[model samples]
Target: MTAEILQKVASEGLPPTRMNARRLFGSFSFSHQPPYSRLPNELLSEIFLYATCRGVDDRHEIISTPIAVSQVSTRWRNVAISTGALWGTIIITFPISRGQISRALTWLKRSRSYPLSIFLDFRDPSWDWDLPESAHPFRWQDMEALIRLLIVHAHRWKQFELLTDTWAPIFTILHYSRRIKCAPILESISLSRCNAFFAARNATFAPAEMKVPIALFGGLLLDCLREVSLTGVHVDWTTSPLRNLTTLEFKYLATDVTPTKDQFADILEACPNLHSLTIIGRGPQADSPPSSSGSTATNRPDSRSKKSARHVELMSLTSFTFGFNDMDYALEILSMFSFPSIKTLALENLSNVDPPALQSLDATPLLKRLSFLDVSSDATTTPFPLSHIISLKLYSISASQATFSQFFDKLRNLEYLGLYNASKDVLEALKPSSNVDFNSSILPCATLKDLECRDMDPETLLKMVKLREAVSHLGHVSFEFSNLCPTLRTNFLDAGIDVVVQTTAQ
Candidate 1:
């Protein structure tokens, strides 16, 4: 047979191969196969749903992989497009373009009845330019129109994430969404990088500009909000309706204006049944803004303040995470919230220490999972109390032998321990010279099961392996090295230690 005939005969069961075969038009001819035809329709539909729905993570990777898969043939395009599950997701990019928005909406419409998960990330500077000439989708004016379409099938919206550093469009969108009196199905809503709010009477960017009144939302959003994260946003009684929320993440940058204590009180008053909260604050931003002279500095709770915050007690909170540059703010939160049931505590950006608060935190017995990012242990001879922690993660420790030993000693029950930048002093103290032989008796971590050490020296790796052998509870130990530490990767493996090394770049 001829090569073409032979090639065609070998591919008889395959879908039309327009991807690599002859093309009749500029675009590949799509084979008219219903998305469900190639496989069980229901199963294929579920697969499409799995592929399209992503929580708060960026879908840039998922988007690229599927596009590549769909390019295999014309039949796949038909399957891809007809399977509304495949195209139901909404991924937002800033400088929202007219052409892009049009294409995205078209994709959503094809999902038949599947609720949409919209990820509108407005980080691009030129996003405003892409507004439709008459009814710009990127403009706040088009918010109602957008929400109207979404609410028509709101039950299908599994996730809604709107993340941006700008504030102008967020409130505008929220104001329009008030008509959604009952969307008992919205699963995730994230509004991050909030930099706008009318203060006692000054604009952040232009103090003289006339301010717009931001309408408060009470009890309207809680009917179905399961996971929510807010950053740099002010909250008051107006947003109290989100009482049903379970997972909440609050973050503010040091460059942000500190809300009056009453503003903070208003938020606490709303969510009574909150289960998990992650608070991230940049102290530098809080100090940058000028506070009104009349504002009270006394954090002592007044009756009115207590009334607002006390009404919505967080009795169900089980996980608490605090990332702060200032220790005072961290202390304030710990003193206020009596998280008797909290099991996880993650502390990040520990620049300074409030000795009193650290002492109070150590007394807690409920903490189980603890993680410290860039933790500073300069306060005293002992490390912070972590007797209750079962899993510990520490990153960016100073090269102090005292600090390293203190930290390791506290994690007696730890099953997972991750250490980054194994400092020079730590490695040297463990082994001053390569010629010195180490044994299992000198190791720490009596109950360690998984151990990961990043960016450490060969001497340190050897010590870690010996330490692992000494700890009977340790089942696996991993030594990860950056590309610059390839020699150490080889040295540890050659020394009979099982190590998994990953390059810093890849």
Candidate 2:
């Protein structure tokens, strides 16, 4: 039977699921076969819907989800063809040839009245040149025509994601999608063009010549929109459909092209129900570029001209990630919001900022329920006022023994701690004190039950975990190591500690 199964797989390929074992077994059957076709149309249709959405995540993973199900058998085909929602999640790559449009339309038609989720990737084209005899460049016209087809069904779009390396396809989409008056049920939209690195490295390659912010989706009514993520894509924040967002991310924008501080303030005011927010690269820019006058900020470090920021209270936001390349730009946005209900906070100073670069981040006034903190900073002392943080992740951080002890002293309730590229002094501070009466903060806090470290010294790790285990503080430990001793893992396992070891590339 095993030989038969292998032989069949070696010859006739199976469906993506490869679940039809009874049929594959051929002649080795039970007294009665289960009535798979006895399932009601509605139940079968629901199964088909599940099959399509859960297919492959890439084309190597994404291609065979629905189509493979439909081609299984006549009964399966009929059932799948009757289910419109099964075809609603459309994934297409651009530069569509002449024949691909008909196929795309078939899927669109089969989708019927169901909501659509479109993922269009026009990244690296397979080929832009077809014929050597004549000038047959990549079918920009055909691609635009395909987008036009998609635009015609824009009313059904529930989720749309368009990503490209160049900006030309985005322009094409924006131009054609203007006809959409309202995506009445569009829930999430992501439009990204990752050409910022090129723009920064080579000043000559400017997309749309760095055009002014434009109204996205032809100023359509996005009453049902919930999540929006834009990277290297300019949109008029003041007039765009940015309100009522549960998740909002704007990244990889230039200072000149970002929303102005006033506009961003209005955006925050409008998004009262926002839950998760991320702003990286240059955020809302000040009226004047901070670097125009050869200064870090408009207000000098000595002048203390920190104007009262237009504060907005985020009562619902639980996860907030903000990284900045410019000090004034970072402060300009940080001083504006108070994340009173924030649970997960990630602060990243992308640049080598000066001492008072994050002075505007007075977390005491903003945060009240922060339980998870991930910070990428090179500071001697901890920045945020964290009282309830149970999980803490530090990246690219180094602190002295005194400072490390002071920092750990504050995280008395910290149970799970992760360190990546942390300095040696930070580790040395974790050495347990011999004095049993010594305060936990004076030593490594014994409250820690879980530890995760990346690219750290194995010797230091073993000693630290062993000492902490002696105090019965540690129950679980996860490590990412290039080379580790075999007995060390065995020893920890024997000690009944939950050990998770991940091997990194040499």
Candidate 3:
């Protein structure tokens, strides 16, 4: 009967039907099912999880699935949404439009039962200036609503981030009033250009009074924090309890109290598991003076207290990058770190008074790569000599042949050299025929494979050739220049160096 029914249905123009009356409502057998239908659900979940986690930049970017995932198929979407872990984050862009806020709220509601994470990125690309006053139709109300929603599930929240130019004072009062509940599971935070506390109090006329009860502003929350990036914010370590943090970076940290290394020691002591740290300004404000010798000590507002209670020791750090605006204090802080496992180090905006600070770093003997940026400081002027650097990248400065020779002579194992400047005299010294015998004292980059020289002049062709020969293992070399006059291009080709010219018109 089933076969006759199937034949009649097929004849009526419907697709051929399988005659399986015995199967009834039961799932089809393995041989009758499509390929991959028999695969275990666990394996499928793992595949989706890996893809979802790949491009995750932070908690915010991961609040939802990447849009491309939906294009796969209906089956994939079912699999993706079924994996509740994939939909656990709520990321929102600031100036939150009604639509965006509504979408984020819906996602948060769906994720409340599971662990939740919220990312608030106030950075808007459309604004010419970063000030909040410039934002059009700013979404403070939307943010307030979102914050209120998260407070209900604060214990289940995994991460919270607030990167904003400013916030309404009412929000601060709400936070202090014990109305702003934070999640116990929250793990990481990043704050940029915000005075979330007292600064908010004076922002407007009907400002909300500060009432948030704090055993600590950031104390209990520090237990699970894995990383923190702060710029222009004061970190109160004494009251804030911290234990297991791995990475901490601070830039332009403005504070009322003078910062000292001791305070830093205290802060580090609080977080015993810290692995990486980048502190941009080393000393107190310029208006403050040194009480001691001819020079003042490096000021760190948090590190000012002399008495050391307990110190946190970081045994897992593998990298450290320091940027200093003040030369004197930068020298002091660089000398303090004992990163036994450090492999990469970068120093930026170093002045003539600052190279002497390099002498303080004696910790990382296993360091593999080092970079110096925007250093116009002269060799004679620098109080310290950097002899340990093997791979070096220099920007915006040219050293005299003698100065460079002296510097490289100390790097016996130096291999990679990248020069960004192409002055005629500097290039001429690199030429083998030039009277400057760089061969004798200069370190031969035996393993050097890549060389890049930018902004060359028409007269520096011989120098390019010499540089190639200087590095015997040269495998790849590229030269980039702009404002290439015809004479310069001809000279570059004549010197046997491959040239790529970029003109303003293009």
Off by over 4 Å in 3: 1-40, 57-75, 112-114, 126-142, 167-185, 194-217, 255-258, 271-273, 282-317, 335-341, 350-441, 444-470, 474-506
Q: Evaluate all candidate structures by whole-model CA lDDT and list the values in order.
A: 0.50, 0.63, 0.49
- Name the lDDT value of residue 182 in candidate 3: 52
Winner of 1 and 2 under TM-score: 2
Q: Best to worst by lDDT, what's the order? A: 2, 1, 3
Q: Would you give me the overall lDDT of model 3?
A: 0.49
Q: Write the per-residue lDDT of candidate 2 for residues 166-204, one digit (tens) a residue.
A: 556666676676778768999999998765442121122
Q: Candidate 1, residues 451-479: lDDT per residue as tens digits? A: 56676665756765664443443566666
RMSD of 1: 12.4
Q: Higher lDDT: candidate 1 or 2?
A: 2
Q: Lowest summed lDDT over 10 consecutive residues: which window, candidate 2?
A: 362-371
